[model samples]
Target: MLVVEQLRKSFPTAQGPLPVLQGVDLCLARGSSLALMGESGSGKSTLLHLLAGLDCADSGSILIDGEPLDGRSESALARWRREGIGLVFQHYNLISSLNVAANLAFQARLAGRHDPQWLDYLTQQLGLMPLLQRYPEQLSGGQQQRVAIGRALAARPALLLADEPTGSLDEASSDEVLALMLQLVGEAGSSVLLVTHSPRLAARLQRRCVLHAGRVQAGPV
Candidate 1:
């Protein structure tokens, strides 16, 4: 489970500091999913990054299964990110030199949780068995994203965070990828917090919240 309370963040700007998040609060139960929706400049991605520990919140706290997330050393945060969180972004971010199989196992191995059987199952579930030998460049955007999702789940992370994960794909492909992701996340029994602007996509999740003026509220749209 994840809990965020009064989360606040600001960034440097020519016009003094521009605040992005102001007392934002959210919670996601284990094995559940929530969609974060917001317009441009609404601080959705900022909150996601904070949760991932890629960036820190200037105020407030993030808790994963009751463990505090703020104020950790860089090394500790890095370790937590590698072993406890599974992240997917708009970009596939795959290693160009690595084949699909290697790409999928990369993070899992880093987390010291690699399971060949689970990897194989993921490959099968993602319809990627035949593409295991192929590289990122050889696949379409949808294929590459599936590989990204597989790689994230390969680590068996307790929580999964996706930021605009289907942003690059066509509408049909987006739906397909989202469905597949939810299915696999269910199979893995991992909680998911997906950041997306699409209401349709947001509605597909079990719950939805909107980020407005730096705070989280029940989705209005």
Candidate 2:
């Protein structure tokens, strides 16, 4: 569902341009799950952002489904993201003013494809039914992360991009959340590209790729 070729990205630094990714190539099949493993400065998150079209790459090409991701304007990318991609971040990016239910339905409603049944199912699956009326501040870190995952899946996106999805949760909570996420993604028939640091977590995925020195290397466990 996603293909990236020779992807390269660099950022302006006080000293010079800081290169983050170089000649990174990856392919994710439809309805498959892949884990990206890397250390702190290895550009895993940057790669996710590039795949999601949240940031532009300095060079190379990205294709989602069959559409090219390069050369699109910011607005065009935003439109594509709304229609095709769902993102889950390390930090739960929930709106403080909105309750869990509203936050979950926000994107789906905006896309003019709100499915109440699906939303309800997601809430129950994420163990978020009781917290629907509560705001982000009222929930614990794990609860908030569940809500974020719910919100991302609520859109019924074709591609799910998750960056350190369990970074803020305890061990039990992380395992629960990750299991739910994998199950839901399969049920929804969506492809996943998850970035994580845990070998145990990475081992659960169908395929694994390690990012180092701005390149991707894939192999068996």
Candidate 3:
């Protein structure tokens, strides 16, 4: 579903142009799950951003289902993201004023692809039915993260990108959330690229890749 070739990215620093990803290459099959493991500065999140088209790479190419993504304009990339990608961040990036239901439906509605039955199913599966009317501030961190996961899946995206999704939750909450996420992603038939620091979390995924020194290490899960 996704293929990246010799992907390279760098940012201007006081020292010079510091490179984050150095010729990274990866390919993700449709309906598969991959765990991206790395240290703090290993560019895992940067790689996810590049794959999601949230940021541009300085060089190399990213292809989604065989379409070249490197040269798309910002608007084009935004449209593509709305139609094909769903993102879950470490922090629950929920809108403060919007209630859970509205927040979950927001992106799907914006993409003109809202599915009421699917949204209902998501709410039920994520155990968010009772909390639908509550705002982010009123919910526990685990509940908010559940809402965030539901929101991401509401769009039925082809590719799901999760960056440290369980990082902020307690152990039990984290396990619950991760299990639900894995199940939901499997049911949705979407390929997932999840970035995480925990080995236990990484071990649960179907495949794993470790990022170090801006490059991906090849090995089995």
Candidate 4:
């Protein structure tokens, strides 16, 4: 469902243009999960941003189900971000003002793809039914992360982009959250591109690749 080809990106520095992603290429099939593993400063997050259209690649192509995500206008990129992908971050970027119910449905509502039944199912499966009325500030880190995952999947997006999504939680919490995410993602038939540092966590995904010197290298999971 996702294809990236010769993806290159560089950042401007006072000295020169520092290259981040140099001819990176990878692919993830429909309903499959891929773990992106790399050391610090290997550009995993940068790759994710480029794929999400939050940042542009200097040269390359990113295709989701044959739809190109490169060189689009800001508005078009915004629409793509809303309609095509779901993002989960380690910070749990929840709307503090909205309660759990609103936060859980926020992305779906934004994408104009809200499915009440699906939202309800996610809520129940994530064990969030009891916290529906509570605010983010009132919940634990695990609870907040669950809400974030629900919000991401609420739209049934074609791809889910997660960047160290369980980094802030304990091992038990992380395992629970990831298990739930994989379960729901499978049910939704969405592809996954997860950026993680833990080999144990990466091992749980369908495949794993390491980023080295700004390129993808197939390796042991």
lDDT of 4: 0.94
Report lDDT (CA) for all predictions. Answer: 0.93, 0.89, 0.91, 0.94
Model 2 earns a TM-score of 0.97
Query: Which regions of candidate 1 fall more than 4 Å away from where they truly are?
Result: none
What's the true lDDT of residue 33 in model 2?
92
Per-residue accuracy of model 1 over 11-71 as CA lDDT, tens digit each: 9999999999999999999999999988999998888889888998888999988989998
Q: After superposition, how far is residue 64 of candidate 1 from its true place, in Å?
A: 1.3
Best by lDDT: 4
lDDT of 2: 0.89
Worst 10 residues of 4 by lDDT: 64-73
Global fold similarity of model 1 (TM-score): 0.97
Worst 10 residues of 2 by lDDT: 105-114
Instruction: Count steric clashes of candidate 4.
Output: 0
Which pairs clash in model 1? none
Candidate 3, residues 112-151, lDDT tens digits: the string is 8899999999999999999999999999989999998888
All candidates: CA RMSD (Å): 1.2, 1.1, 0.9, 0.9
- Name the lDDT value of residue 189 in candidate 3: 84
- Pairing residues by index, what is the TM-score of model 3? 0.98
Give the clashing pairs for model 3. Answer: none
- State TM-scores per candidate: 0.97, 0.97, 0.98, 0.98
Q: How close is candidate 4 to the true structure, as a TM-score?
A: 0.98
Query: How do the residues 1-221 of candidate 4 rate in per-residue lDDT, one tens digit apiece?
Result: 89999999999999999999999999999999999999999999999999899888999899877878886789999988998899999999999999999999999999999999999999999999999999999999999999999999999999999999999999998888999999999998899999999998899999999999999999764
